[model samples]
Target: MRVTTTHQLYTARLPNGGAAVMDVRSGRGQWQHLNSTAALLWNQVIEGADLSKAANRLTATLAAQGAEEAVVRADLAALVSHLRALGLLAASPAPAPDPAPMHVREVLPAHTRLSLPDRAAGLLALATALFLLRCTPIRAAIAAARLVARLPLRPAAPERADQLFAAVRRVRSAWPGRAACLEESLACSFAAALRGRAVTWVIGARTAPAGAHAWNETHGNQVIGQDPEDRIWPYAPALRVRHGRNK
Candidate 1:
């Protein structure tokens, strides 16, 4: 029963000898304060102490501070339960296993013929997406791109998943140097949506060095523009960008 803080949360100790916690994800600057006992418990749990270890430590500390032994034990128990309910405690997630031999070479787009209009729009979108990702914060860039992608556009009839993938890869080739996997994936997704095809944006992770990666998957779970090595990244996604229809 080790404890851990949730995402986008900030914790700090105050001059008044208490702890303050704020939730960044809510976009509301609300804060919660913890008293001495709660703060101590929070620290112990955060430092990787198990439930039994934390409770025993707190019990001894409070008892020596002139608190009654029975009362200290009961109060600690109640505090642990309360914090757990508030999502401040949980079992640790299992780790990713060692990766097998993987071959992750970059794929070049097919030299498929395209109409002038389709080629122009995809290239333009690719340029805009690349600039945005390089210059702006990632969350804001994704939000802005998604908004544009969802806008109404009378594009050519929906293309098959593989054809759409090839078209996307072609647009991606114009991007200078090596772009982040996120940039490539989102650009492809945005372009596909413009062409009236739906592709899912996937974010995955690798554990040993703790890196995050991104790519696209079709509705049928086929990956676009990414190799099988990418498919076996081993860690779960930290984020996913879904289109309006999926929402």
Candidate 2:
């Protein structure tokens, strides 16, 4: 079976140009480090290179770069064994069922409904916020707000979180300006904060097309605002905003 990444973990590039794997599902925040060579192998596997292909590519890349071939082979083997042991790389992928249509309210909790206020006033407010964020230096705009968000703020209930996110998305759809992924994520998180909820904001990038995307997640590590996973699932976490701090 070919090794592949599991969706249960988050992958990020460390400052030293290696990969850091964190299993947020455990809620413990433990991290495993991978050196540059291993990180490249991680990326290759995520790109669907099987065991042999990944190894050959790793060897070839190192040899071309004038690294010792024997050392490269040993390191590659060790990295593979370590990844398998950690369960980050799997032998086979689990079948992913098709996602439901986006606008189907049934997919969300049945109890939560968008109220008249949410559909109108809340929507307007969200649109305005998105517009302002788009026009301003968003990071600077978020500076003051993030201070309050980091103070162990209370979380919005699931129903409310869903409603706020829906409002942001609804407004974004009608926006005449360019509301990119970062803009949308910022607007959603800001709107949620105004309603007294603090969510984790994430910005990530993938190398294939070499682009970035943004989204939000709850403090409990549940994804909030939607992201197009197909384009982003292989992305390494780049910047993260949480508890009023950007990391």
Candidate 3:
């Protein structure tokens, strides 16, 4: 089987110039540390290097140490097998494509306030999302959002998307515990889905800081709830949950 690196992988640059990757799908939130050689190999594979070619190149680098080609190849193969078992490699469909260039930066929507009832509902939705995140796997929490969107309710307008996001963001602000971008975005999606708004939940990774982020967007690619000052331009979209039939 032809397996590619998982889209959920996020790189984190170490102070010592090394890098580590995290597979968010693992649900364990542990980083797989990589030395310089391993990091180079990973980047090469991500950029389309096959195992044979990668092993050959790496082995050549270790020629001074008299590393045998056969041994290096065997080690590389074992590493790949282990990574596949860790959900960091798969023979699966391609992930979400990069967003449209023109719309990418300007897609973020203007925020608006929701009614008191709606705000309360948003908080309830956030609580449910938090509980799911803590008790179930990440995939399960996302699946729950997908299920909620399938309910028989009127589709929410674009304006409602903005209001719901505002409500969710407000609710999160008052919580004593801090929520990561992943959780916050999921909560917003959960609240919107309950109100019949099918939004896109996106998770992306960027290199400089070597981190991952999550956010919500609408059919038109209009982003919701993220601050205009916080630039997501550096991120490459890794996964997307497209819920609505609309564009």
What is the Cα-based TM-score of model 1? 0.49
Ranking by lDDT: 3, 2, 1
| lDDT for 29 (candidate 2) | 32
lDDT of 2 at 16: 47
What is the Cα-based lDDT of residue 66 in candidate 1?
97
Off by over 4 Å in 2: 1-112, 117-132, 142-145, 227-231, 244-247
Count of backbone collisions within predicted model 1: 0
Candidate 3 — what's its lDDT?
Answer: 0.63
lDDT of each: 0.55, 0.58, 0.63
Ranking by TM-score: 3, 2, 1
Any residue pairs clashing in model 3, and if so which? 219-247
Report residue 165 deviation for candidate 1 (angstroms): 3.8
Judged by whole-model lDDT over C-alpha atoms, candidate 2 comes out at 0.58
Cα-based lDDT at residue 130, candidate 3: 82
lDDT of 1 by residue, 71-167 (tens): 9899888987877776656533211112222223334346667666556556765776677776664544545545644555333222444454455
Better of 1 and 2 by lDDT: 2
Tell me the number of clashing residue pairs for each predicted model: 0, 1, 1
lDDT of 2 by residue, 62-94 (tens): 899999999999988887788888777753322
Q: After superposition, how far is residue 246 of candidate 3 from its true place, in Å?
A: 15
lDDT tens per residue, model 3, 1-247: 2222334554544434444565557473445665665666666666567866886787787665787777777777777777678766553223235444313422224355468866876798789878888877675665565565455545455667668777777788788997767777787777876666666776655555566677777756766666757764545455566663211
Model 1 residue 24 CA deviation in Å: 10
Which candidate, 2 or 3, would have the higher lDDT against the true structure? 3
